[model samples]
Target: MTAQSAHLDDELNLKALSFHAQPRPGKIGTLVTKPAATQQDLALAYTPGVAEPVRRIHTDPDLAYAYTNKGNLVAVITDGTAVLGLGNVGPLAGKPVMEGKAVLFKRFADIDCFDIEVQAETPEAFIETVVRIAPTFGGINLEDIAAPHCFEIEQALIDELDIPVFHDDQHGTAIILAAGLLNALELQGKTLEEAQIVILGAGAAGIASARLLLALGAHRDHLLCVDRQGVIHLGRPDLNPYKFGVAVETNKRTLTEAMQGADVFIGLSGPDLVTPEMIASMAPRPIVFALSNPVPEIRPAAALAVRSDLVMATGRSDYPNQVNNVLGFPFIFRGALDVRASRINQAMRIAAVEALRDLAREPVPQAVLDAYGLNALSFGPDYIIPKPFDPRLRERVAGAVAQTAIASGVARLPLSD
Candidate 1:
């Protein structure tokens, strides 16, 4: 790092510490939505009047939606095994991220959230903890859990509970990625079925992205998933079930080999793992989403220096095409909560993908342009995904998800307006 960049990093670190410390040391808190100043309000909020709703709900369990916060509340649960780029920080340290997720939900979707950190010794224990408390909220946003275990926990929760359970690291990344990739392919005059896609990092995000891409019509044979051990081919004996799910029959055994003549490169691995040689080896007009955070696999400047025909994206706000999960999760949960969806099904995910993909093709709003300090942006190489600050995302993505849930018969309530 340069002296200037080092100084900037120091400044950001100090500012972040101060920001988190000054505001009473946390990012979220509960707020009373009802009047509570009088004795009658107390009686209605807690004792006598609350008993009526309790009785009604005891007779018919669905009345909890009408009588309590269950209709619009989400539980942001985490075990801290995979907190951001920092791994295994534990539940106490993971609280801040969960709270940050709650802030985004409220900021973007007007939804209420309770951040829950579980101190469980095993994955089964964590699953039980969340299942026991599942009735308190409309949906669950599983955050910061490690792979393989995360996949198991989320699946168990979805099967056991009658609410949406989403692991944001997995599906949120996949949704935004698919949306951007679709637009990028269109601009490059290619198609998902024909593109040679290589996904580096066979963890949660990489595997999920591969699955969603296949669902969106990408040929399974055209995709390759690589990890620390190289390509996850069919002959690998140590592959987990999740990694094995996306394993293809390929002769390639390394990331360098996998990138040869590839049309798309998705990096969920650590920073600087991709070289300029790898970028140069890809097919013409290749689309690359170097999505590792704080730093990408290959910096945009370095990647662009090699191939100007590349369509690049990162998980950074400073970049032109940022694949942020905030663009998907808030609105997705909003729609699921609004319609009382039984689960966040594949149809709902595809609906979100299409909504985000279609939104980018539309005219960029002035407010969004101002937010980014850009005079204009259009659907092209540099702007393949919708900006997070775009106000249309809430209505557009949420409405599509809710409608798809209803059509797919997983929604218990009809959409209002």
Candidate 2:
């Protein structure tokens, strides 16, 4: 193998080995909210004063937000069926990603998060288990679960629980992706209705992304969705309910026929699926988001070389225009939890994308640049998002979401200035 190939292999191996180390399975720590100094302080904090507040909350449940930590705590729950790029390593192996998500919640939004891994054998049982513990949290963040099942699980949780329930893999990816596409379309001077978007995956992220794009006025008739068995045309013999719904909404001209003049190629499929020839076949200046993890559906070099005018993005952090969902989830949930939102409605999600896109349009903050150990930050085709350490994310993105949620009538409690 070439030196470059060897380096890639080594990096992949190191990542795999690191994940395999079973030393620290999950992370949960306590934070002191009230001072315990004397015996009098302990009595007030624990028994008598606490009971008073509990009594008040029982009479007027809205007082819980004022008295307890429930207003700021989010449950980052997972079943470990779809752990990032690893894909179904089981519940124990998935704990690390859930914990990492909790860390991001604290770092980005000032929200307290608890990571819960349910080792339940079935999706229905898992959903039931989460619902039982739902009241303890202000919001629910479902992560890395597989599709179809994830769709049902999120729907059930949202119906049963009063707090917001978000599945990051599906909606988070969808939201960031929509933001990027909106910006990319502006850069190319095109509108969603005028574009022919061909999606190369029909899983959780793909379906959610397609739905969000369509809701943004992207022409459903002009969209085509393709899965492993090739394009999902209407009346296909073997297609699941979710895939079938996607098939019916998209590919109005039929999948095989629509690819002939497609304006955008979005691949949430497995690695190395799109060839140089496929990209060459696209319309001039075709926008592509090859958003498969670790490795994209089409490698950047090959895609760019074949169509120099093409705008491309991926799920990997190292690449330009990464469509990673981190830009959305941490702050989205933060905003929801901050204002005590009843649910994450479509309006809130659209507001989040708008905030992210607005942030991308501005010159990156000097503080964020300094945190990255750089002197300056600039917005360009290559730099469309703030790095994870960007301090402005909480105030900018989360605040926007909270404001929008209030306006959209989903917030149960508003934050004090």
Evaluated with lDDT, which candidate comes out highest? 1
lDDT of each: 0.95, 0.83
Model 1 spans > 4 angstroms off? none
Worst 10 residues of 1 by lDDT: 21-30
Q: Summarize candidate 2's per-residue lDDT along 1-417 as a digit string, tens digits.
A: 479989998999887767646465345577888889989999999887789998999999888788888888999988899888788888878887888888878876778988899998888999999989987888999998998899999999999989999998889989998888888877777888899899988889989988899888988677788887777777688988888777754334433455566888888888887788888888877888989887798889998888888788888777778887778888998888878889999998998888888888887777777766777666655666556666777788889989988999988777666
Backbone clashes under 3 angstroms, per model: 0, 0
Candidate 1 local Cα displacement, residue 110, angstroms: 0.5
Q: Give candidates' CA RMSD values in order.
A: 0.8, 2.8
Off by over 4 Å in 2: 1-28, 248-259, 372-377
